[model samples]
Target: MRVVSLVPSLTEAVAVTLPGVLVGATEWCTHPAGLDVARIGGTKNPDVPAIVALRPDLVLANEEENRAPDLAALRAAGIEVLVTEVRELPQAIRELDRALRACGASARPRWLDEAETAWLRLPPLQGRLRAVVPIWRRPWMVLGRATFAGDLLARLGVDNVYADHAERYPRVPLDELRGTRPDLVVLPDEPYRFTPDDGPEAFEAPAVLVSGRHLTWYGPSLGEAAGVLATALGR
Candidate 1:
């Protein structure tokens, strides 16, 4: 079965679930090495021509990741597309299950079971860490209320502090941070790679550089990340 995965996390998970099945993926879909597959470009701007050339049996995408124009184009070409949108951990597992079933691939229901077991083992979040999650660098975009990242943070027992704001992602002015006086400021990697030393001197606090995908991605891999982050948080 020829399959093209547009989302990076699915690119990795699909490869694991159905090894030697993926035919194409976006440039960012690099994991489970030696893929060396065809690149169909990024999420927002897809290489339509290259993807068309692949002539895939199934095109796997994510609603929040891929742009509508690309999806419309693929559908216009009569391609069978499966779009997954995951807001929470369970939804992600369900989406993966659905994708596996659609592809006629070998996907066991036990993946969800194992994932749940892993999640149940993590310690509940205890302290309210005043944290800031930066999604971008220039102008500095942060995860606000109603975003997946904010929900994930809440699940992990850490409060967003910005949860009261209505925007999903809001850019805060540097001067506004002065009053917040965060206890732990988290800089997520990708979208931007932030280092502990890069923690601005204007604020006196302990900051941590974390993996964005690990903290925010709601996918089959979330259970793995929960354990990792829980350990990191020493919970």
Candidate 2:
């Protein structure tokens, strides 16, 4: 099946599991390094006309990474769009299977099955660690409520201090984050690159710099994400 993926995670999964299926992808779909395909545009503002011109049989997207209007535009052009929602690991695993099947993967990929096993094999947390996860630093936005990243951390025994906030990704005052007195400050290298020098200095707690792809992406990386993230959170 000819597919155009707007989500990076799905792009990597499709590219790895069913090669030669992707005809187009968003510029932000950067995993499986050296991936070569027609770049539609960014996730939030994809080039609708360019995508329609590709005439892909299926267009894959994430409800959060893509804009509703753009998906609507693609559907209006008679293109089929399958939007996936992944709020947590279980949902992400299910959605990945559903998406790949829609792309004509006759059987589930080994990597997908391994990813599920990897997460399931993770040892339960002896004690949870409280943390403040900052996604963006300009206005200081953090992971709040039912976020995939936050859920991943929780599975690894790190609890988000702001998980009860009204907004999923809320912009809060920097001072307020510091005031939370979390056990650790978890930082990822995307949406905002939080370095040891930049992010950790703002808070008194120790900092854990992690791979955003492993922490956030829900595809092939999921197999190794638990180990990588758990190790980082341990340090």
Candidate 3:
């Protein structure tokens, strides 16, 4: 079955589970290193004509990672688009299983089981460390209510300071971030590439550099995300 995955995590899951099944993917899909596939474009602005030309049997996307218009266009072109919604960890696991099964997997992937088990094994939270997780700079937006990253961090015993915000991703003044005085600032390496030299200076709290793929991705990365993030959080 020819498939095109628009989400990086989805790309990794499908490629690792059913090698040679993906005919196209976004240029941003950088996991399962040495992946060689047709680059459609980025998640937000994928080239529709280029994707349609590949003629994939199924196009995999996420409700938040992919745009509605792009999915609509693919549907209008008569392509089957399976858009998954993953606001939290449970939803992510269920969607991953459903998406893979729809892609023709006879049973659940072992990595899926491993990923779930890893999280289940986490020791109870000793201290709920409050943190500010910035995803972007300049305008400065952060993880807010009902985000997968926030939920994942909660599992790791970290709470997002802005988790109660009305917006999923809220733009806050840099000064406000510092003024809120969170326990620490968690920085990820993607969506903005927050590095030690780049993101830490803006805040007064201690900074913890984390892998964006591990913090945000929900595929095979899930199996290791807990351990990786736990080490980063020093919990």
Whose lDDT is greatest here?
Answer: 3
**Candidate 2, superposed: residue stretches over 4 Å from native:** none
- Which digits, one per residue and each the tens of the lDDT, describe model 3 over residues 19-110? 99999999999978989899999999999999999999999999998999999999999999999999899999999999999888999999
Q: Across residues 123-145, which tens digit of lDDT does each residue of candidate 2 receive?
A: 86778899999999888999999
> Backbone clash tally for model 2?
0
**TM-scores for every candidate against the unseen true structure:** 0.90, 0.98, 0.98
In candidate 1 the C-alpha lDDT for residue 185 amounts to 71
lDDT of 1: 0.75
* True-vs-predicted CA distance for residue 89, candidate 3, Å: 0.9
Runs in model 3 deviating more than 4 A are none
- Please identify which of the two predictions, 1 or 2, would achieve the higher TM-score against the true structure: 2
Worst 10 residues of 1 by lDDT: 196-205
The sequence of per-residue lDDT tens digits that candidate 1 reaches over residues 129-226 is: 77776676568677787666676666677777687777877888866754687776777777677766564443566666678778766555676787
**CA-only RMSD, every prediction:** 2.1, 0.9, 0.8
Clashes of each: 0, 0, 0
lDDT, model 2, position 203: 86
